[model samples]
Target chain A: MLARVFEASGLSSVQISLLREHTEKIRPPRALFCPFPFGLALGKPNDPEFQHRVLDHAFSLLERPSGPVLEDFPEEIVPADAPVTPAEERPPDPAFELTALRGYYDRFVAHHGRTAVGLTGVPSTRFRGLVRLLERYAAGEEIEAPTPDLSAAQYARFACDDIKAFFREARMEQYPAENGPQIDAWFWQQTAMGPMMRRVRDRMLASGDRQVEMLSYGIYREPDTPNPEWKYLTPTAVKTDGG
Target chain B: MPHLKHLPDMKRNEMLTFPAQVNHDTPWTPPARPLREARLALVTSAGLHRRGDPPFVSNHHEPDYSYRRLPADTPAAEILQSHASAGFDRSGIQRDLNTTYPVDRLRELLMRGAIGSLADSFYSFMGALRNVARLEQETAPAVAELLRQDGVEVVLLTPT
Candidate 1:
């Protein structure tokens, strides 16, 4: 939506979209469809080459000098066979232990209490349940189905997001007006939960369980690119002199 | 193009019934100069904000129609994704920040002379807006003004 506004204001705009159908429907000035999973629009993590390629394709649209152009990225996010460091090869961050997560949560509750953390619709009591699920998943054990109130997927979301909230709030309190990067670095690299989540991802990949895969990476299917049959607005083609 | 075959026929029908936003009257504005001589800015609906900035309100009952400004040189590590949309998978972004906000890649482009310069700041807003009218009338135009103030000639947007 903002894309169109930028263009309407006389700035050339291009969008990299995961939902090509929606992009085509909205008809941004220029759109590039990437078949990657939702959050990873550019490419795999730590892969600069792939990210640059996606950006390159997106930037090329700027030269088109037209309206409502939607193009497909001609690549798939093939799983990279990059070597995974063995668990022992990587030293653990003492700060990210389960106890530390609990500590942060406790500190967060003590500081801001339930009123601040309850927004996620996850009661504070469920923190332990979330941790247990993470432990089980990281250990490669079968995860028990969540109770009717909280499905397995919801449990995962609660765990990850709640932990993030705890860390964010705690950082704000500690730094008292510091930049966010310090807190972010601590959460992802220094926290025990970070490695734990990575382990969970590794385990899920190794298990090859379809449901688990979906929960971790999301449903991977082809994007619904615009076709001639769909009723879409195609602006009259106007040739402009190269400026 | 893949058809919406996976969706139930009724759901597909409902989706088709939903109105799509198309404005045929908006004239195309071509860049007046080459990219290497134009200032580029990034505007994303990926719900990205600088770490210390107040996070976008994701609660469905009360959505925030606000945007965040990320400085041109802000490290990808410092940018956080707080989007509440249930549609996209976030694992790739969680693992690598570049997937959503490619600040580093844009910098590389500037160094390589692929683009003339980067805007002083980029903009981000959550795309899961229930208040489309508010966005169109207020937030977008406000951001566009900021972009104009920064001399942004081209924008690259990554919509979540």
Candidate 2:
């Protein structure tokens, strides 16, 4: 679904995994790989061209008629050997970027207008973290931000714009808070949060590695909710359709 | 029939290693449809992204990869320009790849009566996802719902 996300969001993303003994099981006849470490699937530290090459290689593999192929970019010729640079090598933040965090707060206010800090209690630290990351990127520093986890209660009432503003403030050093109140409020209400929640739940369930039943009770014979005939299996079971 | 562009040495070498052996026992044959006459629908992963849609944009770190459909009349130049990598050899020459999967190109075909009508609509998604499980589950179902809703018949999946 990475494609789905990219199509939806206009942003590119990557996935990485470390395969040790299970490397054999990692066979996707249709997939291509880069010569980088398994966990570092994209490329070596801060190399966009090498990363693009890896991605291009992966895309080229799709036209291979049909088959399994091993892609090896051994150490000697690999781009990873290029000299590494420290994060500090990036230029200092722009002038306006200094107020990025404050602007994020203003956007949060404009989107969630007039609420007590605790009402839409998103941690201030996340807001700060987002600003810092945005400032770095705007200064032309290539880096990945830490994925912040916030309490649902804290963000429950925070409108979708508030969250997007948080990320916007993180990625662009400024939030487009001027885009009217209605648009900001409506975006959050329409966000497909259900999927994100499910992803988190799936991760939790897999880590527990056991089948856990969720039971329901009702007062008086409760009206039936349409449960399908099939019992749940892995997430793939729901996706099955004859091709 | 038609000829496609000649495969290069490097590409030919890669092609040779494909595990699926084709021989007389399981020779490739037409699936009982005339490809030229068929009312085709294409689905590609050729980086056709929309703006601000969370699901499509969530994976932005890798590249601006996604999918789109070209209509039958969509100029070949347009496809080549918009999605440079979706190009194929001259023989396979999808002069208008849009003609088949052209969700965008289908409007003219509908007007011209090239085929009965669109199955409903064509679809595009990024094909670079490494986790097939989630893709199969959540994303595929949504696309299926869209296709089913549009009343599509055959689906032509073209991954770039």
Candidate 3:
């Protein structure tokens, strides 16, 4: 994606990594990695109070920035060498399992129903992929290599390709498909992802890393090219003269 | 169901909701050395996205997710017009919030020597996401890689 966009537009770009494994793979202008938890990459939530402090620290790294800076979160929530949780230790609840899956499927329909039909042409197949992915994740199965790059274009293709398979997999008739009340409840149930993301975000918040991260760099830059030396990496404006 | 009444506070100051004040003399702690000096970048979860960009397609949704990068030289008017997600009181928000999510302000600081230097770049994205697992697994990593390559030192995040 970076290569495609950057090369095409002649725009400079950068990438940050929280994991060391990606350093060589991404090959951006520079990179930094923090030992903070997943969602709280920049800082924790609700602690806007503390997040500012962390950002203050992260900005300090910009001076003479080099290849990649992989630093630990300023604060420590877990030991340097903590043990990973095993699947057996975190046994799944069958009842919660059913509910979670149902909820996820329901949500899949609500958010994507419009796009699903347009892209997939058949909505059921999208549900099948959701069920399959959720079941696999719940069972603690390691996802195979090359997880599908569900970028905007690719997702549209996936939806279109798998529309039919969804009906076969979900077996919509088994449940009260008419009013879809149960499905609605399940959709709300899936809302738990927010709290879950927040939980992990809390961990990052606890770690105390403030530097902001971008999803795709330079994709938002203006068209006119500024002087090479006049680099505006942050949110700065450039004066433009009427052509 | 029942209705109850409580006495109001006697203190006049208690009613104020926001910080309402700032102590410029107080030692202002800066972000990390790199982040503190580097041009500022912002990422928000306000979902202030363009028309065509893939608008947070994950099954999870966060309407409040929004973000914007204020160029150091960016005009306050431009900031106001850039994206609707830059929601806040126009006056105090442009300045006071700069003390927090100061992307454009930071760059100006660096240019004017108010600060030493700036990281090569910075970033922003909408703040809200429902399916956090994908957020951590896919989004964070993608963002991390982007920041790393850009050599962004400091990133200001405004979560939805």
Candidate topping lDDT: 1
Kept native contacts, as fractions per model, are 0.46, 0.00, 0.00
lDDT of 1 by residue, B43-127 (tens): 8888877765655653223456788888877765467666633244444454446667777788888999999999999989886
Candidate 3: segments with Cα more than 4 A from true spot? A1-16, A24-30, A76-243, B1-39, B43-160
Tell me, by TM-score, which candidate is best.
1
Better of 1 and 2 by DockQ: 1
Model 2: residues with Cα > 4 Å off, grouped in runs: A1-243, B1-41, B47-49, B55-101
Clashing pairs in 1: A38-B89, A39-B89, A96-A191, A96-A192
Candidate 1 chain A lowest-lDDT run of ten:
A234-243
In angstroms, give how far residue B105 of model 1 lies from its true place: 0.7
The clash count for each model shown is: 4, 42, 74
Q: How far out, in Å, is residue A151 in model 2?
A: 17
Whole-model Cα lDDT of every candidate shown, in order: 0.61, 0.31, 0.31
Tell me the spans in candidate 1 whose CA falls farther than 4 Å from its real position.
Answer: A78-97, A100-160, A164-243, B1-26, B84-86
lDDT of 1 at B76: 58
Measured with C-alpha atoms, the lDDT of residue A34 in candidate 3 is 42
Q: What does candidate 2's lDDT look like per residue over A1-243, in tens digits?
A: 332222232211121212211222333232333333211334332344554455444434333443433344332122112122222322233223324445555554454332122212335444444334433433434534222443221122122223333333332224332221222222223223212222323332333322211111000011132111123434553322211
